[model samples]
Target: MQYQLRVSGNLYKELQQHLFPGDGKEAVAVALCGRYERDGISILLVHELMLIPHKECYRAEDVVCWKTETILPFLEKASKKDMAILKIHSHPGGFPAFSDVDDESDKDLFSSVFGWCESDSVHGSAVMLPEGRIFGRVITPKLESFPFDKVSVAGDEIKVWEHNTSSYSPDDFAVRTAQAFGEGTYSKLRRLKVGVVGCSGTGSPTIEQLKRLGIGELVLIDPDEVEHKNLNRILNTTREDANLRRLKTEVLSSHIRETGLGTKVVAYPFNLYDSPEALQELITCDIIFGCVDSVDGRHLISQLTNFYLIPYFDQGVKLDADGKGGIDKVSGTVHFIQPGSSSLLSRGQYTRQILFDECLRRQDPVEYSKRLKAGYVHNADVDRPAVISINMQISSMAINEFLNRLHSFKNEPARNYAQVSMDYSDGSICNVAEDDLPVDDYQVMWAGRGDLSTFLRMIELSAVKV
Candidate 1:
């Protein structure tokens, strides 16, 4: 794949910081996000990625960029068929020429790019000059730099260089991201199966976003419907959608398929603790997200994820409404539950009491049946009607958790707290994985038939000397 990257406004500032030495980076750099939008697409870069042993510097020096250390690990994680198109850099001076040192570096750099990034494909690199001039170069398998001086960057994507001689131009950022991802990260996820538990509130948006991210198979769990109250949070559902008695999973499945997302949605109306059925879906998903209402559900899902070796991202929101119901205090939490690496639970986020209580409540028939009748067992989870903004926030927050656990693009974004809150009314952000954990003896009692001696005696008595 020929790689191109579009420049976003946010990205422009980041590159300048790394090259020009702003307050941004005292250290390393990184490529944070790869996304698409109507304006164009590009990768989001931030100053946080710099975790190398070398001292970070803004001026030209003997020390290599910390961002450079990040590449090998990324490539090592990728397969041979995938390659990076270019190492986007900046020259604050607006100097068009590659410094003599840059020329020497290009040969060595492109050699590595060909051995890795350009394997069975073509790739390029680019520089953004401080004066706003941009340059790109094509690389051969042998590490020769064919400076495409004729190239131009029109936003995030690059218009093809028309000159036989080196030239330059600005290209579209979105187009470049698409091409880069096609040859690299996105293609690797083509066969993945993702599971979303609870398709209301955050879950609804999460399902939509996952499908958009190109997951091939999704197991959507929920059993609720469209209620006038829920209109506040669920995505795609309108007032017109309310009268139809829409099932959350079924509706979300329809939305995903109708959009040509190419993702297969398996609608599970059953609750997450429903044993055999829940286990089946858990075994099938590559990743799982918890967007359910109950603490019991999270613990159940967390346990399943560990046993199955599937990564799980769980998110929740707590609000303290004021008397007017207009505004008050709110808290949102996102956690990455890895199979074994001292999870959020280890940090005191959730405890055994919360998990067991939830389990008992769900296991009880009266409560389960009641939620079922109210459609709580089925559709979205909210004490009251929900709104769109909160739902999307939860979904995005969950997705963000997923990325933080999976990618090391930047030093983790700062947390206002491990908890997120807009509580002038009062709020806190917390990283509570260390609170309390479940010592689940999910083990079944071995109540096998008592010793057979008594049965033999009874049999003999009944035999009547036979």
Candidate 2:
């Protein structure tokens, strides 16, 4: 099985500060992680970090040794919760590979950790360089060490360090793309597994752009089937598909495969709310695009991203027209969400009442309709006008936002443009900085609580088994 370690941007900054305190000697820290294992992929999501003080360890430029008792408390805690442990240390000299000394130390440490935890689960150790690039190995129950497939830091800028580098030569189709965004950026795209949670409107165009840009893998999630009304917006859909009631994910997956691009696609013909299997696959993605219009769907995705330490790009389009053929408003928004930061809720995208109503409508539509008729719930079932041009525009903007996060070609830092708003009616565009957004206290409390018994820590999901 392949192994990966995921760390939130904020936590990585903390680790960096303690690991490299301007000292020539090595420093060490320990992380208690939540585990996710499925489909031959195992991931460790760091939940807590414990940095050993310099005074507690014997330090040298090449090696550092600390008392095993220093981590006893963490070991006990992890054992109680059946969590995994990862020990990380700094390599101040920029050593590219783990030394023999590190191997022996890991062996001794993980051996004790396994025995104390009294489980066959895996534990790991890693080394971080001065430049913030990390590489690590996983230690098995048998005390055998295997290099980790990759170590990813999910922050304002997504960073991934792979143990083995696969050589990729851009084909003629991608030559223009490589020239526009350096070959390095193109290569990064080929290694990313991106998830698009909707399959129509914005989601269709977003998936098309990602595939053309040579995204390595695409995970498509949507429960709806092709319908006559959506034919105008969903890309590559035909009348025959609507007649056959083909699933949106199936249609998109087929279209991507027909392009002859090397990108792999996995389609889930189910919604994220009720399908534990869909959630299992979604959590494996490196990045997620929220193309759904429902407030509850967006809220759930935001929560999932924070828990799994994945970067999220959420897009929405709004068009209001008077019955008398006058246009009232035309606007759209694209929000760049980093793990452990302000979310769509804190940005006023939706309030608690709206989320509750959406949930009620989804779970008990008959009751919701009755409540609406009784004047207890707002009427949210109106069908809004959807234009292909508007959907494409917003989709392109969201795709560009993802590219900016990867290559950072923008004039200002990405943190300055947390949200981009466009108003076609007023012919105006605006950007909001992360500092301007209110802090999401709820997101902060739930971040990195990965792979819980109940999905996303919701009571409704406890009954669904993957």
Candidate 3:
């Protein structure tokens, strides 16, 4: 089994500050993390750090030795919450591997943490190099250790470090993709698992692009059935499919399988919020594409990205008319939200009232009806203008942004932009830049909050039992 650890940029920075105090001596830090299991792999998500006051520890530039008594309190807290504990320390000497000293100390240390705390939760030890890179392993209750194959950090950008020391060569399909981006990038793309929320206008096109680009696995979620009107925008849909009212996810999934490609596809033919199994399955994806238009769905996706520490790409196209058959507003936007960064709410794409109204409708339809009738809140438009050309343009831009993030072909410096919007009417494009770093305590409620009680307050139906 492969073990991977993901930490938010905010939590990651805190770890650095706590463990790498500028005294050029090693410092010790303790953190509590959530554990998730998928496909025989166990993932640890480091949420927050509980720094130990180490004013009287035996310290050196390469090592720090603390009494086992100092960590018992922290271990007891983790034991009560059933959360895993990580013992993190810094090596300012830029040593990548665990030293002989580490090997001797960890076995005795973690064995004590598990036995003394009386918690079955898995615990591990980590070492941070001078460059802020991390490597760690998971120690079982029986004192067996498994080295992590990868460590990923998600923030304004996505960074990954693989620990496997093996030779890799691209195959023919990947070699062709390497022509544009190097072979290393193509290899990464083949290992990624991408999720698409909506399988309509923007979603269908994005799914087609991802499969053709050779993503390793895809999780497609959509509940709607193909209608005659949907034939205009949805790809891989025939008149027969619309006539038969076939599920949108099934049709697109079938099309991908017919190609005889090696891409793995899992389709969920139900609303994600109503399908707890599908929502939980999203934890396996590396990145997600939000093609949904519902305010409730977008809000869920936003929270899911942060909870799972995955990157999110959200795209939307809109066309408004002046009621005289003339276009008044022709615009679209593509937003890339990194975990623990600015969200759609913080970026002003959505308002608190919208989210509140959506929640009310989902939780209490009777109250929502009364409020709507009293003119307190308005419903979103049911039928909006959609064109295939505009949808394709927006989807293409989103795909290119994903590629740029992976390969960084753009020459400009990287900044965290809340959104990139294009107004076709005025032939203008603008980028709304968000600050470089998140506020110290921003979204603390959701950061590394692996699994919540009701799946971000959607209700009992949204809870993930699996």
- Which lDDT tens digits does candidate 1 get at residues 158-206? 1222233332221232234235344233432344568888887888888
lDDT of 2 by residue, 365-406 (tens): 999999988988877777889999999999999998889888
State TM-scores per candidate. 0.49, 0.96, 0.89
The RMSD (Cα, Å) of candidate 1 is: 17.0
Residue 74's lDDT in candidate 3: 65
lDDT of model 3 at position 356: 85
What RMSD value applies to candidate 3?
3.0
Model 3: pairs clashing at backbone N, Cα or C within 3 Å: none
The backbone clash count of each candidate, in order, is 59, 0, 0
Evaluated at residue 461, the lDDT of candidate 2 is 80
Query: Comparing 1 and 3 by lDDT, which wins?
Result: 3
Instruction: Identify the candidate with maximal TM-score.
Output: 2
- Report lDDT (Cα) of residue 302, candidate 3: 84
Candidate 2 segments exceeding 4 Å error? none
